[model samples]
Target: MGADGTPTVMVVDDHPIWRDAVARDLAEDGFNVVATADGVASARRRAAVVHPDVVLMDMRLPDGDGAQATAEVLAVSPSSKILVLSASDERDDVLEAVKAGATGYLVKSASKQELDDAVRATAEGRAVFTPGLAGLVLGEYRRIAKGPDATSAPSLTERETEILRYVAKGLTAKQIAARLSLSHRTVENHVQATFRKLQVANRVELARYAIEHGLDE
Candidate 1:
């Protein structure tokens, strides 16, 4: 969230028209368009100053790919959540962006409403992905989990495990709170604790851990 409570966003894309158009759309949708950047360098530089609540990132930039831009921006503004708005839904690209610390992934073909919802969810610390891409990401994580590192998984409290199951099933913090008869903040706290314990950066990774451990059911 921004200083004024509106979610602040930064648009990073190489094309001026697309960049400006996204910025305009977000502004019209009630988000504070704090800054716009054309590539990795500008994104990093501007993020350090604005520290936006969300960043709408384009995969192809003049200087580098969105994965690099995502990593750089988060390095400067760790609290900023990145939502990749790209044309390609290729498996490697999605996985790379997620590995680079992006909080969500949305194809450029998504409806404006979907983009709006995704940005809002990203700001609120939810992992958003274009429908099928999420399964692909989860599959990758599942395969990786079969490796030797899977044996050292961390343990969680019963309440934390219950919340993790909800997270893996794509329930938002608010929804989980309602289902568990707990406060929203309490749900978020448990989610954060799960994140810390699992050594995962975001909900996507946490969900992966849950699925790998058969907790998604």
Candidate 2:
């Protein structure tokens, strides 16, 4: 934890240079910081040891993706929040990361000041996105508001829609499975189906859609 009672953070990225630099910046900004340069193994270890309040996890790693690794982290410490730090603007990748348990997302090339502020925002329990991407996240909300026919929305079954409501609430596949008395695989399938039907790319968008349409309630 920080001196101000702010939560500590763990920075995970495969790039040693950027990882160290980001860690140093966060430290200067008064965060208790732990950092790693490996994707799968190191990220897990760091999370286990630090149980950080916020995590700045890279989306891509040599051995695994940050999204894939987030589940492991959550299992160890369910209270920890994850924020993706990625270079890709690929829509599907963003959605998958969010669906996988990340609380927020950020793109690389963000200035030092921007990244610093983002870390603070996330630590304070707020969602953050880059400029253009915020619009994309907002669009999903609009799709729901304008109705299923307003956009290229696809039709979903009752079960799938139920799963989407959980997604909007930031529940993982396993959690949803347990809540609905379905298997993990079944929940994953429902998520994929929702992705296809909505003509949307990722969980983040789906979540916004659910919230926008009042599916979360």
Candidate 3:
């Protein structure tokens, strides 16, 4: 969230028109458009300054690809949630962005409403993705879980584990709270605790950990 309470956003696209349009839409939709960047270097520089709540990233940039930009930006602004807004939905691209710490992936074909909702969700720590892209990400994690290097992870409490399962299933804190008859704040606390215990930054990584450990089942 921004200092003014609305989610702060940074638009990173090589295309000037598209970048401005996205910034305008987000601004009109109640987001604080803190900054705009055209390439990886600018994205990292601006992100370091604004530390926005969400970054609307483009897959292709003047200097590098979205994966590179995502990584660089997060390296500077670790708390900023990245939401890829790419025209390509290729499996490799999606996977690269996710591995680079993108919290969500939305294609260019998404409606304005969809984009608005996705940005809001991303700011709130939810992992939003284009419909099929989510399954692709989760399946990749499951495959990685079979690897020998996936053995050790930090331990989580039983309650935290239960909450993690719901998170892996893509449930929001409010929804998980309703399911468990707990307060939303309580659910968020458990999620935060899980994040700390796993040393993961966001819900996307937490979900990946859960799937890797076969907790999503």
Candidate 4:
């Protein structure tokens, strides 16, 4: 636990072997780890008990989708981070997970070192995605926004949108400030403004939101 909380991690995947393996990996990294090979409800119950710093789950489970589990976890523990884990990097899975509040996404192909870094980043409220996963998430958001039931995006100011474009290009706040001839504090404030308006936590979410709404243009 850093100042925020203990790095307790909950694993929710149906495969017993995989679940145990992930739990072992996290434990080896000194994380307080809990794992369940059950459904979403069981995972939620375990999460409530452990109140983990992060939850790593498979997108598909026996009883329900990990998206619902993510919502439940965030509802119960708003500060907790969620990371989707599975073999599916499908656009729909990626978007659904992000929209449901997951801060990270990883496929089974990830090495132990990569998985460790991803979880650590997520626990710090950062977003992580494998190669090409970011674009997949953005595409799904585009599809959602184009659907009939789509809601209007939060209104953004010119500065906020400009800041968002830089974010979409993967520039850090300091880097963005340098490029835009603004103070670092000013750039950070703009980033925070975007976060609040989009109701997301980190740069990856902000970038995905920006790209989805055509703010990059």
The residue ranges of model 3 lying beyond 4 angstroms of the native Cα positions read 146-217
Question: Over the stretch 1-217, how does candidate 2's per-residue lDDT look in tens digits?
Answer: 5667866888888778988888888888777885554687777877887788898888788888876788678878677878888765555566556666676677787788888877876776555544333333334535554664444444567786676666656676577789999997676565544434433434224442222343334
| Segments of candidate 2 deviating more than 4 angstroms | 131-217
Instruction: Report the Cα RMSD per candidate.
Output: 5.3, 11.7, 5.5, 5.9
Which residues of candidate 1, in runs, are more than 4 Å off? 148-217
Minimum summed lDDT over a 10-residue window in model 3 is located at 202-211
Superior candidate under lDDT, 1 versus 4: 1
Better of 3 and 4 by lDDT: 3
- Model 4 stretches with alpha carbons more than 4 Å out: 2-6, 35-37, 140-151, 155-217
TM-score of 2: 0.62
Q: Which of the two, 1 or 4, has more TM-score?
A: 1
**lDDT agreement with native, every candidate:** 0.74, 0.66, 0.74, 0.66
lDDT tens digits, residues 1-217, model 4? 4444648788888888878888997888887785554668888777776677888978888888887788887777777888888665354555556667776578878899988977887777665644334444344444444655346444457776676566656676567789889996686566444434434422234333322344343
Please give the lDDT score for candidate 1.
0.74
Candidate 4 collision pairs: none
Pick by TM-score: which candidate is best? 1
Return the TM-score for candidate 1, rounded to 2 decimals.
0.70
Question: Candidate 2, after superposition: displacement of residue 129 in Å?
Answer: 2.3
Evaluated against the true structure, the overall lDDT of model 4 is 0.66
